[model samples]
Target: MWLLIAVSVFVGFLIVLYLASPLITPKPLDLKGVHVLVTGGSSGIGKAIAVEVAQRGANICLLARNKAKLEEAQSEIEKVLVDKNQQKVIHISVDISKDYAAVVQAIQQAEEELGPVVLLVNCAGASVAGSFEDLSLNDFKRMIDINYIGTVHVTRAVIPSMKKNQHGRIVFISSQAGQIGLYGYTAYSGSKFALRGLAEALHMELKPYNVYVTLAFPPDTDTPGFAEEQKSKPEETRLISETAGLFQPSVVASSIIKDVVSGRFFSYAGLDGYMLAAVTCGMSPVTSIMEATQQVACMGIFRIISLFYLDHFDRICRKCKQERSDPSSEKKTS
Candidate 1:
């Protein structure tokens, strides 16, 4: 059929475009002497990212709630600095969700000590998983405060400097849960999903200023925060989430940094992460022509593939609910 031939031609064209993507990669920004501010940079993926950028010659300012942990992270990053003279590391403690004034003060102090923050990484976030009815209104509010508003506070503090400089990189650490809603993640997913909208709008608004925005969708990274989240996950949530395998924080941090430097709007780690991003490319901006071509070509196929995943997840939730309702079935399993 003519339709079949058209589809084949489109697929071939897209394959060629994807292969040429690297050739069309955006010009990478120089990080040497760049002032990089990372929120929640005391541990986990945030700490790992701080170490990476530090090694690349960016002065690092780590912000977190725990002074002791931030100090410890600062020490660790100091050990890996490529040039002691080129980059320095410092730590500040503030609860970004509640301390808007303190966050502004910390940024001012960091700018005076280091320089204006050329790169801002919003990595501070919190997650709580439970059935919707079981999660209190406070839980939802807390998730929004810590995950969404915290990002806004740091970003707002840094934007003026970046606008004045006329160049910057702002990275937001959003999870795969942000892209898709999973069971028992009502509060967490809502907060993460909000970042996508924020990042997208900023991308369009900041383009003229040459300030790039990157939203990273890291899947189930093996971080201290993730370990803590596991303790609170419902059985159904755990079973559904396990399908997306855990990744090391270093691997994820590296991938995200690569995307940031490349001026990618959406940064994803691992095969599943890439597939998810591609499949859900919907209205997201594409930095490269090749990327746009690939998304247009692959969207339909990936959507078909995603149905299988959705079915599996739905099946798990239904099975768990059924078990909970049937006392005899639950006892037998126990």
Candidate 2:
């Protein structure tokens, strides 16, 4: 009798939770005719996202430091527009990490041409992988400048309009490195992790005004930036990342756009990403009861799985260290 009663109560609670989910969920943002500004949109995942939004009928403003590349991306994105006559795409050349005034000016130009940006995608970022001591001070500074502060500059510039309009979506394209620290990512990981704090705080401040924030944790992707990153990656870092596999830019961009439009607080690309997000989703805003329940139910299991992953990673580190100390072992294996 007690077992049956317990099952009944659990089922009843789930039903209630499902019914209340609609009340907590934000209405999906429509992309048609909306203005979206994507930093680093001249190439890689940023360009992919611009194409995705353009296909949804949003006017796009691509921001990057290379004018030539920006123009190239603009031409490519223009080809994918749903409305060839009405939908427009523009590009701006500016270093988002260096000059706040330049970022502001660039934003003004975009808004003047396209209209107030209703969606801001903070995708501009840089990565440098090395041991803590091996990385130059400039490397650390550059990662922080481009990945964290650049995001800050662009997000800050767009806040006023988003608040005034009382409706907007902001996306921060943080990597899987942001969710968990790994070998040879001291500089890169620190910068990406900083974005989470900013996103969380901004989510609270903007929620009252109907503006939403989505922090995306994308796994290793096949992009020009990723190829560059591979050159600097330590052997252990490369091996560790390979376990999650590589994703295409289009797949990552699609997941990010879907989450942003749905007003999800945390966006992730794959099963591994979903597990990482759930494990790290402490005290973050809950978009729906279902999401909250999944986090609650899955957190413990995911944490256990993470421990196994950590052990495997530790083994890799130990093996690498052993090989370094005894060069003969590396040669013998080869």
Give TM-scores for every candidate, taking all chains together and pairing residue i with residue i. 0.92, 0.96
Off by over 4 Å in 1: 1-26, 330-334
**By lDDT, who's the top model here?**
2
Model 2: what TM-score? 0.96
Question: Whose TM-score is greatest here?
Answer: 2
Looking at model 1, the pairs that clash are none
Give the lDDT of residue 314 in candidate 2: 99
After superposition, the stretches of candidate 2 with alpha carbons farther than 4 Å from their true spots are: 1-5, 8-23, 331-334
| lDDT tens readout by residue for model 1, 137-179 | 9999999999999999999999998999898999999999999
Clashes of each: 0, 0
lDDT of 2 at 100: 99
